[model samples]
Target: MEITIISAQGLKKLSFFTHNLQPFIQLTTTPPGAHRSHVYTTTVDHEGGVNPTWGDKFDLSNIIDPSEFFYNKCSCIYLYLYTNRVLLGPRLLGWCGIPVADFVDGMASVGTVRWLSYRLRKKDGSKGHGVVNVMVKLDSSVFRKKGGSDVRWLPEVNVGRVAIGIPVRTLPVVNYIIYYKTIK
Candidate 1:
């Protein structure tokens, strides 16, 4: 599975007097029955402050076993938000868990790209200040034969079931915008 840490919004500063929050995100995934989790991180966004965007992509195909990580009900992708402070080191802002079941349907949909948002939570599991957005898709190679030629599955667009929600109207709309591009 491929996961992208797209962006975060409305983050709260750790200190009352702090003006700038240099935010970054850490993604951790632990397969069911595994003793240790694999961790990946995005670069710190110095200018975004309250709202940061990082198009960092992590490929779990090599690190995790698909059968164990995807089918296990207890598996979760943990997201931790932190602020980098030169003198004090990194401080945890908040964290959230994205259950594998949430996107398992999209993965089964065969190359479907799913967009999701999750609210951050404090260490005690209370509601935190920010929301994190991510894009997820299962690699097509996972569904094919090992010795056969690589086959890429194209995403099916279901126009009848699509609903457009316009929260903001100031921006110009582009028809049939392509959201995902395969690298390599």
Candidate 2:
């Protein structure tokens, strides 16, 4: 629950034209299958980036208010960045860590992932190795799958079985399907 790295801009402050953004390690708390209109609150743009599109006007509400938006937690952020490069942290920044004129040229650098083995049958039965809850690690430059094909959400991370849109329900979204996985 210590993810920080916001303040990346260059291609004219990027209004729209992203490549990667699977950065999760959430837990400001909530996180399960989120979507009860996904309440819980950390202000994540009204718990979920209230109505946005195109140049998706950034507004995650001043970095999660009061801290407590853990609706369906289980993401752990680790795609760093790829699509030309941006691996960040643990190596003084990898893939060159942002500097291709700020991205938006050809874009190509996938890092693929998958290591889920979750297990936590708790209601009282209590059994675990680790699953304190709240992780939320999504992929594909911030979920996108309406018109699909922004290169078709490139992320064969490691292929599990079936996963898309954080265990979604309804569809016809504006853009949403950057798959990430985890749930205890």
Candidate 3:
């Protein structure tokens, strides 16, 4: 399986003294109650400076177990965004984790780019200063081929423009929301 870190927006500056926050992503799987998991990272975005853009693509052929991940038992992918500074060292900006099963269920088609926004959390799980916007693409290799599966998600809609009466051609922005309900 492969995933791409397309770009990031609305990043907060960690240090006021230096505007040079070199950011990169650390991808790993966090199985519930597990002590450790496999991790990978993209090259630091040094050129784009703050709010850097890295079209980095990484493959997780060795990271996950096929049997466990397929069953949605231990398939969480944790993404941690960090800034590697020269003097101050690495600082955690925020982190978010999504279930690999979320995509494997065909919620998103192959080659589709989903703009996901996750809340920034510190090492202690407290709120951070900024929100990270990431454009992610799961490679086609993960999708099952030639299946008669029905799409469970709704049709793509430009909700932002629809509510404000803006034409779809003029504004092609979409807002996605996920709701959670506890089942006893």
Specify the highest-lDDT model's number: 1
lDDT of 2 by residue, 1-184 (tens): 1222222221111125433332222222122333322122121211111121111122232333211222212222221111122443321011111111112112243322211222322223344222212212223433233344454432223322345556656777597679878898
Instruction: List the candidates' TM-scores in order.
Output: 0.72, 0.17, 0.62
TM-score of 2: 0.17
Candidate 1 TM-score over all chains jointly: 0.72
Which lDDT values do the candidates have, in the order given?
0.78, 0.25, 0.64
Name the runs in model 1 displaced over 4 angstroms.
31-36, 144-184
Better of 1 and 2 by lDDT: 1
Residue 15 of model 3, lDDT score: 56
The top-ranked prediction according to TM-score is 1
For model 3, how does the per-residue alpha-carbon lDDT over 67-142 read when each residue is reduced to its tens digit?
3464543456787888897866887777777655444543466576565666667777777655655555655444
lDDT (0-100) at residue 13 of candidate 1?
A: 81
**Which stretches in model 2 have alpha-carbon errors above 4 Å?**
1-35, 38-111, 128-184
